[model samples]
Target: MSILDYRRQSVRTAAPRRLYQAALAALALAVFVLGTAASVDGCTPARDPRFVGTATCMTCHKGITASDLRDHFAGPHAAIDCETCHGPGLEHVRAGGRNGILIDNPGDDPFGATPDLCARCHADAVDGHAMTTHFTKGAASCNDCHNVHKPGGFVFASDPDRFLDNAGYVQLCGECHAQQTGEFLRSGHATKDAVTCGGCHDLHVPATFTAPPENNQLCQQCHASFFLGLDSPEAVDFHTGAFHPVDPAGSGASRCVTCHLPPQRRTNQDRGPHDHSLLTLRPAETNALIAQGMTPPPNSCAGILGCHDASVPGSGAPFNLDHPSDNTVLQRFFDQIGGIPEKVQ
Candidate 1:
C-alpha cells in the first residue's frame, strides 16, 4: 500500500516538471530562430519604427524637386545624415506625411524663436549671434540669413547674379536695415568693385563688426595710420604722438570715427546713422553753417562729446562755434589738410 501511494505522487510531480522543461526549450528555440533570421537579413533587426534611412524618407518625399535634391547633395551639409537634423523619420514615413509632427523641422520656426535647433552643430555661431542685434533685438535668426541647401549656407543663391557679386548680400541686409543700407549705398565704401557690407560686418559674430569699433580696428583695416599705433609708419604724425594729445592722455574717445563718422542729425532729431561719407567736418564749415542761420549744424568738431567742449591744448577756450577764425586749433588742422575741401563738405 505504501509503495503504490509513493509511485502515484512521484508521477504527478514528474509530469509538471516535464511540461515546464518543454516550455523553456520552446522559448529558447524561438529566440535562436529569430536571431538566425536577423543575421540572414543583413544583420538588421526587425524594422525599428523610430529610425529609417534617408532613402526611405525620399521614397514618399516626391515633392522635393530634382534641383532641390542637387542643392542638398552639393551643400555644406551634404555628408551629414538627414536624420542628424530632422530627427528619425520612421514615424513620419509610416503616416505618409500625415503626422509631420513626428519629425523635427527647423524650418517650421525659421526665425529660431524657440530653442535654437541649429545650435546642435553650430553652437559657436549661435552663441556669438546671441550677442548681436539680430538676436537681442529679435530681428533675425540663422535661417533668416542662411540657406541650409546652399554650398556656403548663404541665402544668396536666389540672386540672378549669385556669388559673382555682393548685391545679393546688400539686398538681403537691406530688407531690414533700410536706412543704414541707404546710407552705405551712398558712401565711399559702396564701390561695387570692392568693400561690400560683408567686408566690415559678419552676421554670425557679435555686434556684426568684424572687430571692436571702440578700438578703431574696423576703420584701421582700410585706413592704415600711425595714429592707431599699428605696424605701418605714416607720412604724417597728426593723430597720437605729437599733434593729438587726447589719445596719449588715455581718453578712449580718440577713435577714427569720432571725427570722420560723426552722428548725422535726422529730420526728427532722432540719433541717425553716422556720416557714411567719411567726411572730417571742420570747425570752419560748422561755423559757416552757423553764420548762415543753420544753428548747431551737423559737424564733427562741435558735435563731439568732450573734445572741443573742454579746452583742447591749442584751442585756449572752449571752441567758439560762432566765429570760424576763433577755432584756431581745428582751423589750422583744416588749413593743413587743404581747408576742408568741398569734396568732404
Candidate 2:
C-alpha cells in the first residue's frame, strides 16, 4: 500500500477507538446519575422504631374509642396528640412487644403521666392551678378532673338535677370532694335548682374557676331582679350611703364569695378551706338574736347575713338612720344633745 493510504487507514482506526471510548464514558455518567437518584429515593434516615403515630395508639385503646374524638376535642389539652401522653411507640409496633412504648397504664400512670409532662405545654395552667386550693393539697392533677381525649363534652347545662344523676361523673368528683358535693346538693343554690358545680367551675380549666362576668355573675342567674337593681344609680347611691358598708365600686370589683362566704376554715387543719354556704353571717345565730329583739352586728344584712332579710321589720333600720323609730337615729340625736360620745357615731 502507498504511505499516504497506510497513514489514512491508521487515522480512521484511531478515530473509531476514540468514538468507542467517548460512548463508554457517556454510559458510565448516565449510570452514576441513575445510581445517585436511586439512593436518594430508596435510602432514608432510620427513624426510632419506638415512634408510632396516634393511629397506633387508638388501636389498643378500644374502650375509649367512642370518647376518643368527641366534642370537637375542645379543652386545655384537646390539641395534644396521644403520643404526647402515651410516649413513643415505633419499636413496639415493629417488635410486636408492648414494653418499648409507654402506653397509658392506668395503674402505673394513675394520672396518665406526670403532671410535669402535662405541664410542659401547660405552664400557664400549672402556675394558675398552683394558686388554687386543689393544687396546694396535692389532690390536683391533669387527669384528676379531665380526660385528655374527651373534654368539656359532658358539661351540665342549666339543669343541675340531671348532673346529680350522672353516676360516673358523681363518682369521679365525689370520690375526693365528697363533703363539698354533699354540701352542694343540700345548698339553697342547688336546692332551688339554680346552679350546678359546672355553672361556676370550669372542669377543663380549673385554674379559671369562677371566671369574670360569671364568677359573681353566676349568682345573678337566680337573683336576676336583685342584680339588675344592684347596678342601678339609685342602688349605687343607697349602697354607698349608710346601708351597704361595702363601697359599690369596691364590692363590684371584689368577688361575691370574698364577702358573703369568706374563707374561715379549711377542709383539713393543714388544707385551705372555702365556705360553700354563700353567706356573710351565721343564719341560725342571726335569727336567734333577731328573735331576742336585738339587732345583729354590723356587716350583717342581706348577703352578709345568712338568710335574706329584705322584709324584716328592722332589717333596713341601720341603713335608714334618719327614721324616727331607728335606734341608730335616736342614739345619734341623743349623742348630739347630751354629748355622750355619740352612741351612733
The lDDT of each candidate is 0.58, 0.45
Cα distance off (Å), candidate 2, residue 9: 95
lDDT of 1 by residue, 107-131 (tens): 7774655336677777888898888
Model 1 bad stretches (over 4 Å): 1-48, 60-69, 98-102, 110-115, 158-165, 225-242, 245-254, 266-272, 282-297, 303-306, 309-317, 320-332, 338-345
Query: lDDT of candidate 2 vs native?
Result: 0.45
The numbered model that scores best in lDDT is 1
Report the poorest 10 consecutive residues by lDDT, candidate 1: 336-345
Query: What TM-score does structure 1 among the candidates reach?
Result: 0.64
Q: Weakest 10 consecutive residues, lDDT, candidate 2?
A: 335-344
